[model samples]
Target chain A: MNFEEGKKQFIQTWGKLGSEWGINRTMAQVHALLLIAPKPLSTEEIMEELSISRGNANMNIRDLLGWNLVHKELVPGDRKEYFVAEKDIWEIAKRISRERKRREIEPVKSVLHQLQEVEGDRSKDEVKAFTDMMNQLGGFVDKMDKSVDIMLSSDQSWFFGMLLKLIK
Target chain B: MNFEEGKKQFIQTWGKLGSEWGINRTMAQVHALLLIAPKPLSTEEIMEELSISRGNANMNIRDLLGWNLVHKELVPGDRKEYFVAEKDIWEIAKRISRERKRREIEPVKSVLHQLQEVEGDRSKDEVKAFTDMMNQLGGFVDKMDKSVDIMLSSDQSWFFGMLLKLIK
Candidate 1:
């Protein structure tokens, strides 16, 4: 396929992938456009290209910034803010992992821990089963939490290298 | 919370958490119910508990079965098919990762690989950049693919043990 067609295909695929990763379609499309564009793009350019309203563009861009997936760029003479996505694929994955760990993993782990305090007889099958389930799930999350911490501290080459070795 | 209350809360939370992980709300709820239920539930029971229609319940249950999250059981002397979730959390997680690897990661890697063959002058900035991006993303996916394969082959205790040690 040609350049324009390839670019379009990339954005569409990225959008769908984003939905699977818990990101909304519009935000993913915006990020996809910025990721593929040769340079930083202004909000108007983003809205025009994606056929989105100004409000929609503004909201998704703000959400992207919150996710640390996009950054604000300042044009030399232009007053309007421009935005660009973190193009390095490794960095993008790290940012996503960090945010999800904080948003989803941390809270869930906390709840699982708290459930250990359920006042009940440990000998009862129902009570033991429930507590055991929580403890098992909690333990798994702890390991994962530590693993991601180690991963985020290392560079992509080192992380992938370790993963490759461990997988073998 | 008491056992029943805590169970209800856990189901609700799991359903919401499932949405963030790309499982739709109703399907997740159905899975959550089955996971906590003492025994297999018929389609009518699942529908009544979740307040979902027969078609909706059937479709989601079929989808869950396809994902290996739920299984069909034949109750003695009962004509209706009953369903049970794979209640072991580790097994549940393993099934999800395995399915996602098949449905999303593998196909995405294939496309990214094909994009490398886009016939164009390599010297052009856009062409070179797009090709490079795809290659990097593809490489990350490749590493993840291998990592998952290894994880899937092992039991939960062994896999998580290795992960904890590696991270430490």
Candidate 2:
């Protein structure tokens, strides 16, 4: 396949993957574009290459910046801001894992803790059984979250390999 | 916390986690409810507990079923379908892995393969680079998926322990 067609297909596929993971398509497409670019690209360049609206280009760039996946670049004697993505796939995975843990896991842990205090009919066997099970599940998630936290703290593959050993 | 407050917190947190991972809020809440229920719940019961519209409940329930995370149960002398989540959390995780592989990863891989055929100068370079990276990623995910499949297929803890040893 030719360069332009191949680039377009890559962007489309990456964008679809992003949407399935709960991110907007344009954001993923912009990331894909930045991933393959040889140098930092200006917003205008991104807009032209992706055939996206100015607002979309601007918004997604900001979101990527917030995720620490993309960054603003200053060009000598250039007025327009340029952007680039983190080139290392491993670093990208770390950032994603940290963000997910912070945004999703921690909050869920807090709620699960609160739920454990519910004084629902302790005398009733069913209610007791349900709460007991919920407690067990909550404890399980909490342990997993701790393991994820440990994994996120380092770039050590051996640590994860060890944890994987413990799963059974 | 009181029962009402605790339940509310649980639902809200579960919904937030779901959204971050690409599942909708209602779908996650329904799953969470099923996780804690002592018995299989009828659709009407789920609607009442969650205070969601019938259509919304039906749609999310169907999604959960498609993921194989929820099962339909036949009640004696009852026409209304009952639902229950797989009680094993590990099993639930394995099902999610398989479903996501089918629904998301496979499609992305197919497109990546197609993109490799695109011809052109810079575009070909871009396509080759993107497809190469995706292929590597696909392999990683495929291995982890296979591990999950094997883990769920039997009650053998020693094999899982061995796989975790490999990961570590």
Model 1 CA lDDT for position B112: 76
lDDT of each: 0.83, 0.76
lDDT of 2 by residue, B38-108 (tens): 78999899999999999999999999999999999998999999998897766776788778878887777
Per-residue lDDT tens digits of candidate 1, residues B112-145?
Answer: 7777667778899878888888787778888888
List candidate 1 stretches off by more than 4 Å.
Answer: A120-128, A166-168
lDDT of 1 by residue, A116-151 (tens): 557677787667767777777778788788878877
Off by over 4 Å in 2: A153-168, B113-168
Candidate 2, residue B55: the lDDT equals: 97
Provide per-model DockQ scores.
Answer: 0.54, 0.46
Question: Candidate 1, after superposition: displacement of residue A165 in Å?
Answer: 1.8
lDDT for each residue of candidate 2 in A1-168, tens digit (9 for 90 to 100): 666666777788889899899989899999999987767999999999988889989999999998999999999999999998897765787787788778777777777776777887888765675578668767767756765665566554554455345444
**Alpha carbon deviation, residue A68, candidate 1 (Å):** 0.7
